[model samples]
Each structure stands twice: as structure tokens, then as C-alpha cells.
Target: MLERRGVMVSGAAAVCFYEVCPTVDQYCQLRLIAGLSEKAKEAAEMALPKTVFAVSGYHCCDLVAMGRIVGDGACHLQLCDIAVHPRLQRQGLGREVVLRLTAWLDKNLPPSAEVSLIAKGASNLLYAQYGFVPTAPAAISMCRRC
Candidate 1:
């Protein structure tokens, strides 16, 4: 897992994470983040051509199994779209990606840099291992359906 948010690269066998969007339209179609279609599109368009870091070990040469970091460098970084194909799950690829990204954060971000992520399901355990404690003391997280 290369940790530079938006830094793209390809290759690996079992570690490929999908390259989601080349445009906002594609991102909305894929992620379907509720009211986020328009906003996500704008962001994706701005961030496209940006190298979203990924990992892979599938031996195929695509970054099809990996995770990504999205945000402005330095201040705010959000870990997003972390996926390892269903076939690749339980093989520690996800953990590897998180660890790699954490290591990159440690090396690059300033001590005050704020790194964040929204985990899906039980995956919070993995993020916890990387020091992503819940934001409880600050505020409870919530999502509303439209």
C-alpha cells in the first residue's frame, strides 16, 4: 500500500484494488454515496489524473486490489475506497494496504495532520490497529438516508 494519497501506480498479484473513477460520473455510478453524486463528481474530476495509491499481488499488473487516500496533502487526508476483490479477502491484503498507508502517513504527514476514514462493517478493527480510534470524544458519527 503506497501511502501518498492520490499517487497512482499499477501492478501486483493479490493486492490489486480497483481504480474507481476517471470522472465524476463514473464515481457516482460506482460509489453511489447518496447525495454525493454531484459533489463526488466534482471532486473526482479535480482529483483524476491524481495518483491514488493502491496495492496488488494478483500477478496481473493492475492496481485492482488496493485502497486509496483522497484529500488535500498536508492537512486533511481521508482513506477511501479500500477494497480487495472478494476472492482476495481473508488473505491479509487489506491489512497490508492499511499498514502500508499508515507507514506512509507516519513518514510524510506532519504531526498535526488529520487523517481520517470511514470503515465499512467490521473493518473498523483493522483501522483501529493503525491508530484510527473512534471520534467519539469529539462527536458521534451518523449518516442519514435521503
Candidate 2:
């Protein structure tokens, strides 16, 4: 089990326990329920152990939110799999997870490290508050399913 790092109380008075990294099963289930793209268990197994930093939030014993940073420790880092359960959306759980992840990055990353994340839909709005901006003319994000 991931150890508890902190506790949060949502606006609706829901108490949530936060921890560093979730188990593979919790990671898969939370992403599905939170509407992120599905990732295969094998992929998750290969990936989770490579995470540089991660945060998972649970309401009681149920996982409700998560975020992770992946990359080589020095040069490249990307924020991925940020999610919050629909029932708990707008309660700041997502923001809290991002906040914790960024705080960790601030302390741990080298000065030259480039951190990035692909924001989908209006999620760029949420990420914007934390200093992310459109790469635009200089660069545009593009991807294809594997």
C-alpha cells in the first residue's frame, strides 16, 4: 500500500487521504472511472515502476484522483494521467494532486529540466493556473495512437 502523505477535505466536506503513487490496479481503475484513455495492464506494470514522482488521492479506501511525472531524472519530464473522479470533480482534488506534483518537481528537478504535459480539451485551463502555456508558433503538440 502507498503511504499517506497528507489529508484533504473537499468543499463538500469529503475527507480524502493523499499518498505517493497508487497500486497498479488502483491506477487502472481510477483512469477508467475518471474518463482518461485506457492503458493496458502490461503497459501500466512497465510504466508505474518508472515514475519519477506520483500522487494519488483516496476518499476513504477508494481511489479518486491521481497524477504522475515520468522521464529521465535530469533532462525531460512530463506530467501524465492527471484525473479526478466525476463525483469529485470541481472539489480541487485534481488541483491538489497537481499542486503536490509540481511542488515535488520544484524541489527535485534540475535547473535545465524541461517539464511538459499534453492538455486535452479545456484541461489546459486548469493547467494554465500552474504556469503551463500554449507552445503555439514555436511548437505544437501532435500525437498518434500506438
Candidate 3:
């Protein structure tokens, strides 16, 4: 069993999962969550190359879910691009995905490793419940494409 944020998860398994396509459908769902344009071709081009996606196929048995963790293995990790289909929302699947990913990180990343993520809307509260704190007072965040 895995526990986080007053939730318990079991009976699910995640392998050494990786996906290159991750489906345009799934991509569009995640883009909606992030408040990005679901019709933006540039967003699709930008997201496809950077995502390392995982999905669940146990209960509802579909590729209607996804998440990603991108970073150097030793010191930094960023959890991003998490999305469950609209029909599956509020069914505890998102928490399950985050739990599995953090479990993977705990086992694989170094002891002092720091994981970062850009949470969408109230999702920041979800991540905070998993021990993610604001990177404030010490440093601010910035991004650029190059």
C-alpha cells in the first residue's frame, strides 16, 4: 500500500513505463488542466518531445490517463503533465498517479534530491499535501525556451 495526503492506494502497478506519443487526446486533456489552448499546435509540438507519460489500465482499463516526471535522476525532478480523463476525475486516480510517481522518485532519486512541479489551479494544494512547499524567500522560478 501507498499513503499520501490522508489517502491510501493499492492493487495498482507501474512498470518501467515510457510513452512517446501519449495520444493527442490525452495531450489535449492535460492542456485543458494547465489552462493552455487545447487547439494550439505549438503546444502539442512543445509538449510531445518533453513528456515521459504513464497511464493506468487496471480498473477502468483505458489509456484515458497520463502523468510525467522530467529531470536529471540524481538531484532534481519535476512532476508535470498529470491528467486523468474528465469522466475519471474525483475517483482518486490522480492521487494514485502522484503517489506512484513519488514512490518511484523516493526509490530512484538521491537522498537530497528536490522534486519540483507546476501545479494547476487547486492542484497546488494537492501537491502541498505531499510535502511540496513553495520555493519562496530562497529563490523564485523562471522559465525560457531555447
Best by TM-score: 2
Displacement of residue 13 (Cα, Å) in model 1 is 6.3
Give the worst 10-residue stretch by lDDT in candidate 3: 1-10
Cα lDDT tens digits for candidate 2, 1-146: 45577888886655455546788999999889989989899999999999998888877778888999999987999999999989889988888988898888889888888999999989999899888888999998888988
- TM-scores for all candidates? 0.63, 0.92, 0.65
Error of 2 at 45 (Å): 0.9
Clashing pairs in 3: none
Query: In candidate 1, what are the lDDT values of residues 11-116, reduced to their tens digit?
Result: 3332333333323453444344322224445666666556444333332543334556767778888887665545445666667778767777888889998988
- Scored by lDDT, the top model is 2
Measured over all alpha carbons after superposition, the RMSD of each candidate to the real structure, in angstroms, is: 6.5, 1.6, 6.6
The C-alpha local distance difference test score for the whole of candidate 3 amounts to: 0.60
Q: Which parts of model 1 are misplaced by more than 4 Å?
A: 1-46, 51-58, 62-64, 142-146
lDDT of each: 0.58, 0.86, 0.60
Instruction: Return whichever of 2 and 3 wins on TM-score.
Output: 2
TM-score of 3: 0.65
